[model samples]
Target: MKNIKLTIEYDGRRYLGWQRLGSSDKTIQGKIESVLFQMTGEKIEIIGSGRTDAGTHARGQVANFKTESELSPLEMLNFLNRYLPNDIVIKDVTEMSERFHARYNASGKQYSYYVWNDVIPTAFYRHHSFYVPQELNLEKMEKAAEKLLGTHDFIGFSALKKTKKSTVRKIEEIRIEKNGAMLHFTFIGNGFLHKMIRILTGTLLEIGMGKLDINIIDEVLANKIRQDAGETVPAAGLFLDEVFYE
Candidate 1:
């Protein structure tokens, strides 16, 4: 058996979330798995490092699958690229030991969110970023983001109703930058609860627009209530930047 690791990039605009739903072929995993099955003539199952919500794009999403095929890594890469949709690309492929599991062995991940901070609409970034017309108070947003840059219980930030697993996560960094009319928010974390980054960005945007107080970050963290946070931003602005194993 050969464990093949694949680094994939995709524009998730037209698909459902990453996971293969019941009989749903419009998912990232389902699409790729179909191609792999056709290529190897085996029922292939691919395990992704994580799931990105619907319409969320990815620059470097990682996944792995075990197969008994004799194809080399380069051949598999080329074959997948030739058969996969144009929006999806196989960036890299490598053979790994059977001990490697994409989701279980992942150590960390980095996500990026883009905001178009401008009064007029942007042609290039129409589908790439969240458009906010009101001028944002960047300084206030930065101050609010600083309060989120450490280990904490993020139950208040997630959209899930309940989970047996712990909600504590370590956020290594939260970088907010501006270029021209674009506002960029980068989050590097050991792990994230579902919709955590989107909720964080929404809360920060509210702070930027004076809808929420800057000190509300502390209140939300202490309260551990989802209602204390702001809107869940659209998935179109979110990108899976990288998945780390080491």
Candidate 2:
């Protein structure tokens, strides 16, 4: 048997997220696994680095699966791209050691969120980015985002109801950039809790609009209050940019 690693890119607008649901074909994992089964004649299960919420896109998602098939990695890649939906694409495939597990081996991840910060919404990026008609104070948003960097218990920023695991995750960087009417936010972290990025974006936007105070970031972090954080923004604006492995 051989372990195969796959680099994938997908537009997740129509899928039900990454996990394979029982008897549900409307998922990214299910769609890929189904193709794998067809190619290998086995119920091959691909393990993703992490899950992306519905309507969340991925520019460079990583996954791995062990298979008994004799086909070459390039052959497997070709077969997958040929049959999978147009919205999903297999970018690369390579053979890996049996010890290589996509999730466990991942060291860090990079995510990007896009926002349209103008009154007029464009038909092109309507589905790709979040729109905030009110002008945002970019300077304040940047100042507020700086507080989110470094290690902290991010439970207040996450949507997970209960998790026994530690919420003390480190955010290496949070960059907010403006390109015309578009605002691009990039986050690099060791790991992200459920809905953490969306919540962070919402909070920053609120601060930018003067709906929340810059000092509130310190309050939320210190208090660990979920309700104190801003709303969870739409998933459409989020993207899994890349997964890092060491």
Candidate 3:
């Protein structure tokens, strides 16, 4: 058997996230795995770098699976693309060392949240970005984002209902950049809890809009309460930008 790595890009607007669900639901992983199973005649399980929530997109999501097939990486990529739906594309594939696990070996991940900040939202970007009619102070948003840098317990910024084993994760960088009417909030972290990025973005947006004080971040972190932070932004605006591994 050989372990194969795949780089994938998908439009998550039509699916129920990456992982396989019941037979009725469509998923990115399920779509790819179904094609692989049919092509190789083997039942293979794929491990993704991370789970992207429903309606969240990905540009460089990675996954790997073990299979006993003689197809070259290029051949497998072509075969999968031919059979997979148009919304999901297998960008590249290569055989990797057996010890390489996509999730376990990942060193860090980068996520970006996009917002269309204007009085009138553009139709072209409606599906890809969150529309916020209020004016945003980018300088204030940048100042607020700086507090999220470094290692800290992000309990306040995660979904309140998760039973995760831990909430401690190191954020290497947080940057807010603006292009025209679009604001991009990018975060790089060792790992993330469920809905963590969206919540953080929502908090920053509140600060930018003068709804929440920037200093409130300290209290929220200290309190470790979900309600202390801002609301979770919609999943449609979040994207898994990249996954780094060594």
Candidate 4:
């Protein structure tokens, strides 16, 4: 058996997210598995590095599957690109050692969120980015973003009611940049809790709007209270930028 790793990009406007739900063919994973099954005539199960929420997109999502088929990685890539939906693209594929696991071996991930800070919303790229009419104070947002760097318990920023896993995660970096009316935020971390990035972005935006104090980042981390965080931003604005294994 050969273990194949795939790098994928998708516009998540029409799917139910990355996981394969029972009896549902409208998922990204389900669509890819169906294509693989058609090609190999064998049921193929793939493991993704992580899951993106519904309506969330991906630019470099990684997944791996073990297959008995003799098709080369390039051949498989060609077939997948030809058969998969237009929104989903298999960017690259490579054969790997049997020990390489997509989910278990992932070392870190990078995610990006985009916000259009203009008052006038353009028809183009409406589905890919979030529209916020109010002007944002980029300086205040940058200050707040600095407080979120390093290791902390992100439970306050997450949406999960409970998790057996540890809530403490190390945020390696957080970057905020603006080009004209577009504000972009990028986060690099060992791992992220459910809805963590969305909440962080909302809180930062609130800080930029002068609605929330910049020091509240420290308070929330110290208190570890979910209620202290800001609103959960829309998933449409979020994208899994990359997954790192090494």
Model 2 misses residue 25 by how many Å? 0.6
Between candidates 2 and 4, the one scoring higher on TM-score is 2
TM-score of model number 2? 0.99
CA-lDDT, candidates in order: 0.94, 0.94, 0.91, 0.93
Candidate 2: RMSD to truth: 0.7
Q: RMSD to native for every prediction?
A: 0.7, 0.7, 1.1, 0.8
The residue ranges of model 2 lying beyond 4 angstroms of the native Cα positions read: none
Clashes of each: 0, 0, 0, 0
Error of 2 at 150 (Å): 0.4
The total of clashing pairs for model 3 equals 0
Model 1 — TM-score against the truth? 0.99
Q: Over 4 Å off in model 3, which ranges?
A: 160-164
Clashes of 4: 0
lDDT winner, 1 or 4: 1
lDDT of 2 by residue, 1-246 (tens): 899999999999999999988999999999999999999999988999999988899999999999989999889989999999999999999999989999999999999999998989978998889999998899999999999999999998999777789999999999999999999999999999999999999999999999999988998899889899898999999999999999
Worst 10 residues of 4 by lDDT: 121-130
Please give, for residues 49-163, the per-residue lDDT of candidate 3 as tens digits.
Answer: 9888899999999999999999999999899999888889989899999999999999999999999999988899888899999988889889888888888888888985656
Q: In candidate 2, which residue pairs clash?
A: none
